[model samples]
Target: MSGRQTSFLAQALQQGAGALRSRQFDLAERIAGDILKSNRTDRNAVLILAHALVGQDRAGEAIAPLERIARRSDDGEVETLLGALLCKSGRAADGIAQLRRTIARRPPYLPSFQELAGQLSKAGQLGEAISVIESGLALVPESVDLKVDLGRLLHESNEFAKALEVLTIARDAAPGRPDVLIELGRVLILSGDYTAAADAFRHVLAQRPDDGSVRAYLATCLLEQGERDAGEAALRAVMRGGPHLLGRAAFVMAASSHGRFFFDMSEATKFLGGKST
Candidate 1:
């Protein structure tokens, strides 16, 4: 292509990218399609088109164009996205295979590992999912996201100690990350360290005070630790969060009644009887 053509392609790609960021999927799709018509092999145009299709909930349609890019180049990111799209389209086996191939290349692409691990987990291959995450951690030792996944998987597999250890490292690496803290809090709860779990949840609440789910978890930790007044107070606060939190609050109340400390039934009835707040 001439310099002018190259410049035009660049400008079009920029506009398409901006449209995608703004969630103008139809506009982005049009721009990407026009660019592809001029140069069928344009990688950015193909990616933009795929993203636009996905944004519009047409993930299956995005797969073929991504595969077209995959055939021309060994782009691991594209392969990862293709694999994920295939899974989203109900082709899990094919997607898993593609993701495995992408990871086997060891191309420093973190999403390949994450997507493969997630698929394996959904398929009930927890061991393989854990292995995939561990492999990714080996490749990217400093990746807090990988560590968080490892921690969560470990917790699911009943390896609470290891999960706590991994999440602690992740927390140290990224102290204020809500995801890391949430996973850590869960592991702590499993480990029967209610105090530590409460601390973790508290940190997250400090950052996201309006998060009803976290508030409920914090109430659980408080109740499990036998802090009745505080736990009840927290539960009431959760109830006040609105109708969305009612079920969780009730669940916490019921759970506390059978946990380390029994919640008084009368108090539960009294609390549930009132309007929220």
Candidate 2:
């Protein structure tokens, strides 16, 4: 392209990006479409259009534009995104294949591994999901996100010991990370170590004081340890935190070892009021 044409395209890309950042999906889509009309293979234009479509809840429509770029470009990020969009558009097998190809081509690209493992897990291929994450860790040993994911996958597979070990490494690598702490807390709970679980949850609460879900988990740990009074107080506090917190607290309660179920505030109130539902 000539200097003037290149300059024009650059300006148009800038405008589209600004529109996207400002959440003006319609304007961004229009700007990207105008750029693509001049050069359909333009990477920036394709990405902008894809993002705009996704922002408008038209994710499936973004797939064709992304695929157009993928055909001409070996860009790992683009292909990884295309793979995710394909999965979201109900083409999981094709998406998984695309992600595997991307990872084979760009082994160090983290998103390909993450996306592939996520898709595999969702497809009930849990073993492969674990292997994919382990392979990613081999390539990027210092990736906290990969470690956290591996830990979660192991936990889901009922490999609590392995999950706890992986999460411990992740916690050490990323001290004060809320996600790592939260996962560690959950693994500890499932491992039948309520004290350690409560400690882990406390660390997360120290970081996120208003987190009712963490509070609920902490209460479960306390109750498991026979600290009924403290646990009840925490549950009551979560109940008073409005509907969202109350629902989350109830979910945690039902999922934990206590096996309690609370459908609404009134039910929760009745249980804590000594009716013990």
Candidate 3:
């Protein structure tokens, strides 16, 4: 390629990346397609096209371009993305192998490992995902994100106590992080520690007063503790502040009441569409 052609390709690739970041997948793909039409082996064009395809949920079409790049480059990130795309496209075994190879060749890149762990978990390879994440944690023990991810995987596997332990550590490390607090609260609730869960939700509410989800969660904790009136008050407070909170609060109240009739006849009539006509 001439200097001008190379420069044009580079500019197109840069524009494509920007489009991808802004979620303009169609524009990104168009730019990538133009570049690829001229230089079929352009690595940047291939990578960008593959990413755009993945973003557009066309992972099947992304495979050929990704495989081309994977064959030509030793980039662990590329390998990881290809693995994830493969997994998303139902090629689980191939995806797992790609991720494993990338992890083996490269040092512990947290993002890659996290992606791999998620894909592995989805592929019913929970043991492998846990083992990989645990290994990564050994290398970066203080990483709150990694801890949270491992905790989430553990929680998904119904290891609620272990998830709680991990999330608690993450919350202590990043005391004011809303995400960590939320996850900690979730695990606490799952572990049947309603009181602590409520406390965690309250901590989050202190940091984010406008968070309707936290308010709803706190109300649930209250209801779970047999504080029906208090829970109802909290839910009412949430509903008053934001109408969107009403749906969530109603859901919590419904679940809490075990779908039983807790309302007066008039209120029940309203919910039952005016006595079922």
Per-model TM-score on C-alpha atoms? 0.87, 0.85, 0.79
lDDT of 2 at 39: 85
Model 2 alpha-carbon drift over 4 Å, by segment: 1-15, 18-22, 251-267, 270-277
> How well is each residue in 45-90 modelled by candidate 3, as lDDT tens digits?
8878888888888988988877887898787767888888888888
lDDT of 2 by residue, 1-277 (tens): 8999999989999999999999999999999999988788899999999999989989999898889889996888889989999999899889999999998885478989999999999999999999999998888899999999999999999999999999999998888899999999999998999998899999998888778788888999987887766877777777666555655666555665544766675776566442333
Question: How many clashes does each candidate structure show, in the order listed?
Answer: 0, 0, 0
So what's the TM-score on candidate 2? 0.85
Compute the lDDT for candidate 1. Answer: 0.87
Order the candidates by lDDT, highest first. 1, 2, 3
